[model samples]
Target: MITFCRKSFIKNVFNGQIRCKSANSVSLSYNKITGCVTTSNDSLPPVLIFHGLFGTKNNWKSISKAISSKTGRTVYSLDLRNHGSSPHTSGTDSTLIGMANDIELFLDDNHYKTATLIGHSLGGRTVLQFAYLWPERVEKLIAVDISPLPTIPQQFFTKTTFIDELSKSIENISNDLNMSSARKQVDDRLKPLITDAFIRGFFLMSLHKNEESEKLFWKFNLNSIKHMLENEYINKIEIKIPFNGPSLLVHGQQSDYVKKDDYNAIRELMPNVQIVSIPETGHYLHIEKPNHFIDCVISFMKLS
Candidate 1:
């Protein structure tokens, strides 16, 4: 059911100490917002996961763990640069293609001739670009609740609305307050729009204590993310090759990201793309309806 080729694509990229279970293992330390996670694993086409804006590898832990346990395959959830553990580099270099290159290099370094890449929101765009660049390297691609086309971020929360809420929450946080208290304050402010308690909690988790100043700062580089908001979300990259690999494009029936107009272009780029619409869910379809998301993935992976 799995075909893992044991061959080195790019040798000596990392020290020879980068061990593997088979010859098909390459490890690449990707530098992003925080730092990097060395990804190297066994046969069974590995699942490379990418998180959305304001998310980290930790966000994908639940679904990834479940997927790995159910399928017995290696699942890699990456924290894109400027968002999670990946180290933040100067400038807002958050191009979709550029981010995909990091994954490509990771695959090359880790001996994985091909992989199943799953991404959500901003990450969906990144994965699309990745497959566009290296169609042969992707065995399967899953895009959750987002397409390559531009969508309005303000739909989540109007600029004035988010700013006003954040400002009020910031004012409540004192030097003496604990993370729990700070999170509670922020949660109270975000409650109206972000109904999911778990997501609200996850966002709160990104807030870290500054050891020196004793102030709380977000782990993600907000500046870099904000800077690329316009440039990164646009539908600029055209797929040169119609990626013939198995593709699953899952979207929420309530989400505006994947509109009817998108179908022609999506099918044009990937003639084999399959679309699944999860009803009663919005942009955060996976998080809003985890079971449905898992079921769709399981059914698709089992096929062929």
Candidate 2:
């Protein structure tokens, strides 16, 4: 059985039935609707995977299936709110805490007493926030290519500037044009800002056809995400307590997101964390080195 909350909660939010004074308001009660694709086999401890920014559950489909088959544990790849098929939210509800709350509701609605969380980039921060807020609910945690630091130091470019440029490029794609032309136009505009073909292609995945208008549009809630990124996601995480559960921090050798200097700080927060670095890979380690990524996850899960 697919255990998830009814889609009504999302509808209510979209209809303006739920309102809050601030983004930090705790009175908000409706479940933040999310989309997930799962591979199950009546497994005891399920693994929930969360994708990074501009990514959806589809990005992790093959990985989730492989993990499920090899480890004999159910694997779920979730589309965080405002991304993929998940419901979009605005204002305070788009913050990191809000995202964590959504995950909490997901677990509760599904009757999952505890789960092992695997998150990449933005999703990594979400799972970390979730574990911090509700340590008892997480059996384990795996953060990929992200640090628990207050701000993300620049690697490819300034994070804010990069996202803003990318957003503009996406917006520049003409809606009236055919998908192929729009893609070409988007690529042309993004070429100067983003030189890497792989990264540009990754961002392009968010583009989809609008059924009514027959136009290509972004599946993600770009405005909401931009707001969150500026106000919360890029800032330092405020955590009250550390998650003592078994934790794994995986980084790519070619990635600068997780720096050597940050290890002590990460250890201070997650004492049980074991750090692993995959060679010759960048921020998207899972995509660049799927076999190594899968092996690391499986090996970690098998540990007694």
Candidate 3:
């Protein structure tokens, strides 16, 4: 098999954040999901990573690099619509089905018949829906801290996250800092409004530089995220047809996102499913135990 070193498909950075080759640059289209593809080896089926709620493709960049360098598989870290650098639309385009469709369109746009998928939280559930709706497109599944059973939106997230307040504070955001410490500086800027350090960090994930304004702004649309809370069904998945594909459910020991009883429903949808739990970790297990998370994914994908 031919093995290629790590690489990116991006043409340039839109200020500090990534800007994948747009429709004008490559055959890629913006209406189709936009993402950063790290590392490449044409011989193996690629591994795609999806971020959870309030997260973007940058959240998994290091992990994607590690997985690709170690496994020799192309890794695509995608920013699902309404989040990150992807186009934000309202109504139908904001649902899980919309995200699943974006993934489908992404594969077709890239000319890949099938690929391994790894998604966390909402991204995980979206991939599950994708598998149920388009089973043939998925070669393998790795869902972290999520299940097929629907999750109540209000219970997980809502306006309580202070997204509305933060959206209003975008104009006051500081100049772009092209360094790792930028998170802390931004965190300090938001610290006055959002007291909780953890919650502040979550909101900061969507923060990006506005190419025209030159001020740090959010890539995600506040309305779309808030809309999920309004429509309860947006969080709940209704996948009736069995996906019947090799799938993995990574449970977080400290998180209530995946309950004990959810396994039967998960197995019902993915009959050939394996459930693994990481100790001392919550919903964002990847951040807590990144190495363990990588190990679990690589082992299941048979890259180790």
Candidate 4:
């Protein structure tokens, strides 16, 4: 069973006073319901946000709050299973279908019969799978910075190497006695593998001192995520029926994740899809251009 944090606890997390913790024992079921940080109100058809791989609900806090206030609707930012404050399950539990089922449970647990789903990267794939499996439950769908292509072996290998190196760097940093030293050591090690400073900073956001362990560790389940990225996340989606809901696909113009060639396949699965591109940004378009991203979402959501 998933339990929400008290409002005070949620506030502490936002203020950087404490790391998020699970409020109750996590279920080991395949369709395990995950935790969430919500900006709720008595609004119909809430907007549900799902973060990318190696990301947490914390990453979307500001965005969620903004969207909630702007749209006059509740916004639920979720920590997909094995990441953030959610339960850490095996790689098999990290498959697209498994993640989609988690979303289904979340909606049911919260008494939400329908919602607008917004997801980024791996989360995007999850929402797409959810729309496919439970089309009637989705009011709308928005996918960010991802394509529906099968796993490319070379691309998979490249990402695997990066994640492996990153995990090793974090493990080494965890052994350092001094927090400052650990931070420096982690940055030094990551600088070589991740050239982009922004990307490096983004990854560091997952690093936090675990109160129980009394050591610095990644908030995400790195090993499980690595396995999922290698075996499940990159694989091609094989769904025959398309989700006929109002759908929007947002891409970062500078990112190759959603290229021109992938549009046909996207359109094939989402016949009524509207595509939007944010310029001068990469895969993390929302982070790089928040205003444009929000504008695109608002415009798409308002369309009749």
Candidate 5:
């Protein structure tokens, strides 16, 4: 038997800031991280997944379901702040460390002492920040196609090359999301700008209807993401404490995000970490090869 849990609670209860034992915190408004939880076994530690930039909790539905179904353990696929149904924040509050703070609040609200943390791309960086600051809260950590340092500008360029396309697509689509043809309209508009059908479909996954207002919207905070690209593209990950627990780095063989030269630097931060490269995959390796990706993560947990 399997159980599904969806949470949308008011998590940020503090007035000013709630600093973790690591003494790290981020600014925010009244925002909460939304997640879909799947559980088959309550005894095993829970697993929480954070998606990459422009992705939502829905992106990991299949993987989350598969993981929980296979291992009989709880799995949570979360929407990072300023993305998905989660509230959008302004400039400084939407950073990787800030997202880490949101994850901290998420654990506290759920009363989870520790969990297996898995993240991809920007999400991978967010989990690393969390593991570094709150090492005790993470039972095991898996990062997909990411490293401790910031990605080069080419990274954002290649992944988000469809920004101009996206902007033009938004202009062409109807404002009323309630229309039955809204989804098709979105797809049609994006066709010209984004030539790759697969990448276009992946971007299409970010579309969501606002039931209350019947208005068009994206799951991600575009301005905040652009801010990161412009200003913090080269900013190093902020972490003083090294997480020495069970850790895995799952990178795509075809991706340069985690280069061969980064192994030693990563090892210095996480001495017990192991790196696995998925053949012929890119930054979105999990989406391209979910079964292989799932096997890697589950096998790592079994060993840990």
Candidate 6:
């Protein structure tokens, strides 16, 4: 189980007084669902937003707020197991099926009879499985930059190697005088590979205080994350039920994650799926291009 600061933290972050405690809890039983945040307005159906590998609820904060304000809907963002403030436990497998189960528990406990699910990367895969398992509870589905099949191991290994190297570099730096120095350390390694400020910001969120001392450390459970990466990249999950609801599959033009070869499989599983490609962007399409992402989501939401 994971312990969180509950509604108090949320209140401080949003600067708004949330009136309901029916769904407020800082700490939760499943490590994956902790640090979850929810914002609700009077008129819209609940929207569930799931983050990618090593990502937290904070990753989607800006986008969630933007979408919530525009749609007048509640957006729930959760820190998947072993990430962010979520608990690191024996159940930290990080598989699609395991992650989808986390969503199931979250929705069931919160009295959300159904919701529109939007997920990215690993999250995108989780929602697909969730819809497959409980199609009746998902009104609409959106997958951003990932598909339902096994991902290439080379990509997973490359990302893992980058994070591993970055983590070691930060840990070895003893005398960090200021934020600028700390950032410089990170930029020295990452800037060459990722020039996008938003993507870099996403990686920086993992940097935090170590429990033992003032030395900064990554919040993500790296060992388990690395372990899960190998499994997820080379495995297939059985989906007994195909989600037969309205779905939008959005991929980045520069990304090879969601390829043309996977479209037939996606369509076979999700008969009503529509695919969209955003130009000049890659894996982190939502963050790289918010206006385009929001436009796509809004257009889909307007559908009956």
How many pairs of residues collide in model 1? 20
Among all windows of 10 consecutive residues in model 5, the one with the lowest summed lDDT is 2-11
Per-residue lDDT, model 3, residue 161, is 62
Give every collision pair in model 3. Answer: none
**lDDT digits (tens) for residues 268-296 of candidate 5:** 99899999999999888998899999999
In order of listing, the candidates' clash counts read: 20, 2, 0, 1, 0, 2
Over the stretch 61-126, how does candidate 6's per-residue lDDT look in tens digits? 777867777676777777776778776644234565556667766775676768889999877877
lDDT against the true structure, per candidate, is 0.70, 0.76, 0.72, 0.74, 0.74, 0.70
lDDT of 2 by residue, 1-304 (tens): 2233322233212133332112322221221212233433454667889898888888888888778777667777888888888888874467676777777667755778788899999889889988887787788899999867776754543356776676677564556788888888888888888789988888778877787977667788777776775675545466888779999999998887897788999899999999999999989999999999999998998887
Query: In terms of TM-score, how similar is model 4 to the real structure?
Result: 0.82
Candidate 5 runs further than 4 Å off: 1-39, 156-165, 175-180, 209-214, 233-235
Tell me, by lDDT, which candidate is best.
2
lDDT of 5 at 261: 85
RMSD of each: 8.4, 7.6, 10.0, 9.8, 7.8, 9.0
**TM-scores for candidates 1 onward, in order:** 0.78, 0.82, 0.78, 0.82, 0.81, 0.78
lDDT of model number 6: 0.70
lDDT, candidate 2, equals 0.76
Model 5 residue 221 distance off true place after TM-score fit, in angstroms: 1.6
lDDT of 4: 0.74
